[model samples]
Target: MSPLVALVHATPAAIGPARTAFAEAFPEAELWHLLDDRLAADADAAGGLTPPLRKRMLTLIGHAVDNGADAVQLTCSMYGPVAALAGQLWDVPVHGSDETMLRELGWSRPARVGVIGSLDSAVADSARRVAEVVPGAEIVPITAAGAAEAASSGDAERLSAALENAARGHEVGVFVLAQYSLTPQWMRLEAALSTPVLSPPQLAAGELRRNLLEAP
Candidate 1:
């Protein structure tokens, strides 16, 4: 059987981009999506990841594992840390949304890294993780104003513009899109700003394939 990769999404906007990423990067893997639309809203309302929210995330992950997922990827940056805990509990591989992206950034050892996200919490969380992996680099957290709304409404132009405006003044060695929902806009943002842009989904998909599908 093809390796089944479960993608747990905190918001609906992430589903399409993730599917596209996996399709391109690891087409042979079977993809399963589990979305909890209210997850992002609750986390935002709580101002961060609360104990209950963490438990809820674990429960969702546990369900995915129980349902025959060979590997699981959390698509929400805010809930990323939960993936670590899930990994300890489950035998299969578990990955946070930005793990591979942050790891690669650390490898590059960029002087300054810009992290762009549609939501403040997601940006902050991603920035925190980036700092953990690349302690020496400066982390710039850029919250693209109105980007969440633009993404939810499927306004690609507005989303791209918001991200570009937020990124314009920042002089960073590399820019990372901190949210899976924002991945689709990375290419256009990179072109407009003339800077290297990194997003999580594609990188995560490739990593999963290398570890699970290609490994002997």
Candidate 2:
């Protein structure tokens, strides 16, 4: 039997590519994309989740359960509370975008962590991961909204500039791209000549592979 998972996409973003990467890792499960209009909605520069976003996610996950998804994976790293609450409300194996990052952090690093996101929720995700993993490590979070916008429009140059701006003060440090939204242009940003970049898509995909493969 094929296990099905619902991919609740809150933004009008290219999250499918990231999920495809995850799917390649878990060939047995079928992936579904469910999008709500809320993704096009803008975030306050402060980057926190607005009520629109919370409601959006709630509605999307509800739809997923109706569709009979065996599991639900909310792919946005920024929606931390939403991720936990949705997992509990749905009673399934809900995967948060940053959950893998934290688990991986436990296995690695004492380096300064630079987090990249187009939204505040993503910054929070990386900071939370660093806090849980690095312990007293400096976590610098930056938003590449312009980059995200360009990526949606298929402009890699604009995305690169957004990364450059977000790259400020990340000298010689480890960086994590917290939002799956900025994932397409993730490679455009230069963290630090000395720092290694940590990407949520790659991390999340690996996590999905392990879980789906090991689960009985």
Candidate 3:
């Protein structure tokens, strides 16, 4: 039987790209998607993950485990803290999509890490994650104004242009696209800049496969 990997998403934009990454990286694994777009809104309204939101997140994670998921991937970057707690509670592997990518960047000990995100909260949250991984590392967070709305509205070109503009001038060792939803625009951003662009989906997929599927 194939391993079941449950993907938890807080925004619609995350679903397809995450599925695509899993398909490309671990075709043999069974994929399950769970989405609650409102979770993102609530988190934003409350200025962070409120207790109720965290409870719902755990409930969702438990539901996935009960449904026979061999592993769970939190594909939303904003849910990092909740995901970290869930990881602790689950015996199965639970992946915070952006965590590994940030950790990898942190190891480089870069003087400045540029972060671009569609939402202001996501940018701040991502910066926190980076600091957690690399103490004292400088993090520069950029809000890709209107980019999220463009992506959600299916304006890929506008989204691409906004992201490119946000990342155009940054003298950082690496530029990290803070959300998995922004993964598709990675190449466009990369081409227009000299800095390395690190997006979470592909890295998370590879890490999930290695940790959950390939582990003995």
Candidate 4:
């Protein structure tokens, strides 16, 4: 049997595209999307990444590992810290979605990096990661005006617009589409923002390919 990649999805909106990306990128491996609204909803419910959210995510990670996932890709940008905390519990490596770009998006000029998301915590955390990798870049996090309702029901247009709108003002923008569900909106939002959008799925897919190919 081919090794299966365990996709732990934080938000329902991101689950579909994340699995899609997994399929396209790692066709040799089976992809499993285990969606958890509890973790994401807690962050949303709290208006950001709170301790409660982290605690919830930690529990979810354990559950995924117990179920026999070969590798784990956590599909949340804001829950970076939670993912980090959970790395010790499982035998398989746990990857954070925002880990895609590393510090490559950072710059010394203090460029404004807009981390737009439906959840306040994701936006804030993605910004910090940008700042960490790129020393002087400024991070501006804005929530989509009404994306949660739209995304839950599968409204791609609204999600795309939300990404574009969140990135409206930056001169040297790097938009981190925090969720997998928003991946389909890349092209549409790219036309509107004209800013660099860093997607987690494709980036992770690339890494996964290399790792798989190089595995002895």
Candidate 5:
């Protein structure tokens, strides 16, 4: 039987891109989506991950594991740290959204890494992780102004433009789109900047497939 991979999403915008990524990267795996649309708004309102919010995220992850998930992936970068806690509580492998991408970046030993995101919180979290993984490398946090609004409004052009505009001057060894919502724009962003662009979904999918499906 194909392994069932549960995707825990904090926003609806991440769903399509994540599905596309999994389909391309781990086509044989079955997908289960667990969405809490208000998760992001609640985190933003509370000025980041609060205690109650953390509990709620854990509950969702637990539910996914209980429902026969072979592994779980959190699609929100803001609540990424919660994955670690969830891993302790569940027997299934639980993964934070950007872990694989950040790990790869660390292996590359880039001199400077640019983290681009629609939300400042997500960018900051990703930048912090980058710092942890690549201590000697410079971390640049770029908040794509208006990109969140554009994404919410379903304005792809505006989203791409905002990201491009924000990323215009920064010349980094590699660029990381910190939010899963920004994954769909990675190709365009990479082409415009002429640099390697990394996003979470595809990398996470591949990692999960390797660990769960290909492991001997």
Candidate 6:
């Protein structure tokens, strides 16, 4: 039987890449999307994660739990700590979208980590996650200027072009796409650079598959 994995997303942009990852990497696992754009709006309004924000995240996890999700993953990279706490609370495999990527990069011990994100908050959040895994790692945060707007406007070409531009001229072991919306440009970004690209959606999907389907 296929395990059901619930995906909690703070923005609409994460949905497509997440769904695509599930289809491409682990189609046997049923995918469920729980989107709350207000989560992002409120988080932004508050300037950071607050106690109330934590509670709200827990509530979303609870919803996934009630729906019989065998595992839950947040498509939003900014909520890494919240997802960690949720994993403790739920006794299930709870994961932040970029956690797997962070772990991989940490093991690689890259001296200069490159991060590309659609929003400033995402860039900061991803950099912090990278620091957590690889202490004192030099992080270069680059904003995919106008990429968020292009994504929201449903202009894939424009978003890809913007991310491609933002990712160029970076010398690092790997470039991390801080937002799932940027995953579609992973191959192009890899081609443009001399390093590999780490995609949150792909990594998260593989993590879920490893924990659920491949766990022995």
On lDDT, the leading prediction is: 1
Total colliding residue pairs, candidate 3 = 0
Task: Provide TM-scores for the models.
Answer: 0.97, 0.81, 0.95, 0.85, 0.96, 0.95
**Candidate 1 at 103: error in angstroms?**
0.6
Report per-prediction Cα RMSD to one decimal: 1.0, 3.1, 1.3, 2.6, 1.1, 1.3
lDDT of 2 at 20: 56
Model 3, which residues run further than 4 Å from truth?
none
In angstroms, the error of model 4 at 201 is 1.9
- Top candidate by TM-score: 1
| Model 4 C-alpha RMSD to native | 2.6
In model 5, the runs with Cα more than 4 Å from the true position are none
Candidate 4: tens digits of C-alpha lDDT, residues 13-84: 777777677677777767777777777777766766777667777777777788887777888776777667
TM-score of candidate 6 versus the correct structure, residues matched by position: 0.95
Question: Which residue pairs does candidate 2 place in steric collision?
Answer: 11-39, 47-120, 78-121, 78-122
**Residue range 88-192, candidate 2, lDDT tens digits:** 787767777677777776677656677777656556656776777778777776776586677677666776678767676666456777766666555545432
Question: Would you list the rank order by TM-score, best first?
Answer: 1, 5, 3, 6, 4, 2
- Give the total clashing residue pairs for model 4: 2
lDDT of 6 at 149: 88
Model 1 clashing residue pairs (backbone): none
Q: For residues 1-216, could you state the per-residue lDDT of candidate 6 as single tens digits?
A: 789999998989778888999888888998888988877667766766889888888899999998799999898877778888987787877888888898898789888888898878778878877877877778899998999888777787898789888877777777898888778778876876757888888888887888888889
lDDT of 1 by residue, 30-67 (tens): 99999899999899888889999999999989999998
